[model samples]
Target: MRTIIENATLILPEGILKNGFAVCTDSIISQIGEGPFGKYNDSDMVIDAKGNYVSPGFIDMHTHGAGGHDFMDNTVEAYLGAARTHARYGTTSLVPTTLTSTTEELLNTFTIYEQAKEQNTDGADFLGLHLEGPYFAYNQRGAQDPEYLRNPEPEEYNLILAHGEKHIIRWSMAPELDGALELGRLLRSKGILASLGHTDALYEEVTEAYKNGFTHVTHLYSCMSTITRRNAYRYAGAVEATYMIDDMSVEIIADGIHLPKSLLQYVCKFKSIDNIALCTDSMRAAGMPDGEYILGSRDKGQVVVVEDGVAKLPDRSAFAGSVATADRLVRTMVEVAGISLSDAIKMITRNPARILGVDKTKGSLESGKDADIVIFDSDIAVQTTIVKGKVIYTQNNNLKS
Candidate 1:
């Protein structure tokens, strides 16, 4: 099937172009330009974009769960349910992240990815799995299970690599742990992204790890150490290393609660939109009203209640996860942080796509790229979300499909 979207304002790498027309043939975009359409046949389906903003679909690089479903459960339904909720919010691609768990549990979670990849739900495209635990510093475990936290083990790494079966795209770790650098090297050898997170490593350790192959940072300031003027040591903290390293990409939770609005603005000042990716780090409570929800597996701990956008544990620590969606993240960036709409969109779309190495297929609305696009009104509420040329979500007035 061929479809043509006419009379829309398209967002490109350079800037927004008014009065643009985009044509889609099956799953790939065929043409995008200004002016009259003379080459198309009469049978092609046409959608009047009505001057609305049309851009690449959002990509969530780090998300835990949604719709009362968690990836930690290691179930097919849980994965698909989370994907569906995110898709309705203009996210076309996402990585289902897992919390720290036992080796057996981690493998079980990896097996579920095969099922998610095989099934196509009417939600965001399941790009792959991101393992976010087990190799983290115990002090910065956040919501991860303390019992399961350990130093990197080559045997365990080999087991996961052997069974991952192409669905595992990234792994989050603490670089200061024993054998972590070697594990990072191994992950790089297998073409899997190694992300630094939940660490108390000095700046020198992080920089050395980056040289050894850690090219990404997970949830930049949440579980990482900050630099202080009093502790002017030889090694910089995670925060300092992140700012100094140009090649590394950093993920930030833009829900406003994780990091203060002022702090977020400061971080964005140093990190360009190209190197800073916006992630929800959302849990199962996302898209659901304020209520009780789980972060890690229920067996390891009880579910936390979400009150006023914070997911809190029993001890009353700040929410380790969030309820914000990708659409809301974009709006918050523009409305609160004072970032330009184009830069905010690039954080969710182009930046994440580039980090995941899927830019050619999923990043932008260019010809020959995948037809993953989102349409929204002036207020930025999602009106329609199309993935791979298929309309997965449509909103008409108060009604949704």
Candidate 2:
């Protein structure tokens, strides 16, 4: 099938192109040019963008679940449902993430992920599985089950990796923990992304982590250390180390709530667009009404309340997770952090695709690339989402048959 989207402002890699058009042949982008497409036969599927911003579909590298279904729900239906929910908000590709859990639960998720992918239709394409951890610092393990948190165990991780090496794309953990450097090397050798998260590591530990293949920081500022005093001596923490490292990539939960405007601005001001990615870090309550919900698997997860646009523990002492969608993330960056639309879009698209090493085919709107596209208005409200040239979600039946 030939699909042409015309009369749009295309978000190209270099800059925005007004009155642009893109053509999709099968599942790949065949052409992108300025002005009208000139002629179209009845066989062609022409979509009028009405001057909306047509950009690469958002790629979320870290998201647990949405639409009342967590990936840890341990069912194919749950996986598909969450992906579908994010697609409606402009996510065309996403990595299904798992919270800290048992060895058995992690193994089961690996099996379930394989099953989910085989049946994933009408949803955002699954990039791969992101294991958020069974290894972390107890003091910094926010929202993660403390019962399962521990230092990296060579025997336990090696066993998990042996079974899941094929499906796992990335693993986040506290890099300062014992045996973490070895695990980082193992994951790197397997070409899996190793990232730092929920860590209380000092600058020196993070520097060592970088050499050991921990190239990314997960959810910067959230559950991560900043600066500390050790016997009246100030020491840099993971948060500060990220800025000094220069090449370290990081993802942030930019829900406006998880990070207030000032903190969001601070991150944007310090981090280059190429070195940053936006993630939802959302839970099952995303796209659902405010109320109580679970953070992981239905039976074993912790209970949290959803209100005030974010999820929190019942006592409201800490955030359990976010409820923001892909659109809200872009909106938060642009509207709250005062970032340009193009840069904010890049944080969710090209940056993540590059971080996950899938940039060659999925990140930008170029010919020969996957035709994963999203159309949104000035407000960053998603109007249509097309994954691999398939129009899965369109607002108000905007596209004609």
TM-score of each prediction: 0.95, 0.98
Per-residue accuracy of model 1 over 1-401 as CA lDDT, tens digit each: 88787778888888998888888899899998986545667677677777888889999999998888888878888888988999899999999998877778878877777877688658789888898978988878888878788888888888887888487889999999999999889888888889999998888899999988899999989889776455564545998999899878999999888887897898889876689999999988899998777676655656788987768885676566888899988988888898999999999999999998899798888989999998876667887788998878876442211
- Model 2, 1-401: lDDT tens digits are 89899999999999999999999998999999999888787888888899999999999999999999999999999999999999999999999999988899889988899999988879999999999988899999889989988888889998998899999999999999999999999999998999999999999999999999999999999999989999999999999999999899999999999889998888878888789999999999999999999999999999999999999999999999999999999999999999999999999999999999999999999999999999999998899999999999998545644
Error of 1 at 164 (Å): 0.5
User: Count of backbone clashes for each model?
Assistant: 1, 0
Candidate with best TM-score: 2
List residue ranges in candidate 1 displaced over 4 A: 36-42, 228-235, 396-401
The reply for model 2, stretches above 4 Å from the true place, is none
> What lDDT score goes with residue 270 in model 1?
88
Model 2 lDDT vs. the true structure? Answer: 0.94
What TM-score should be assigned to candidate 2?
0.98
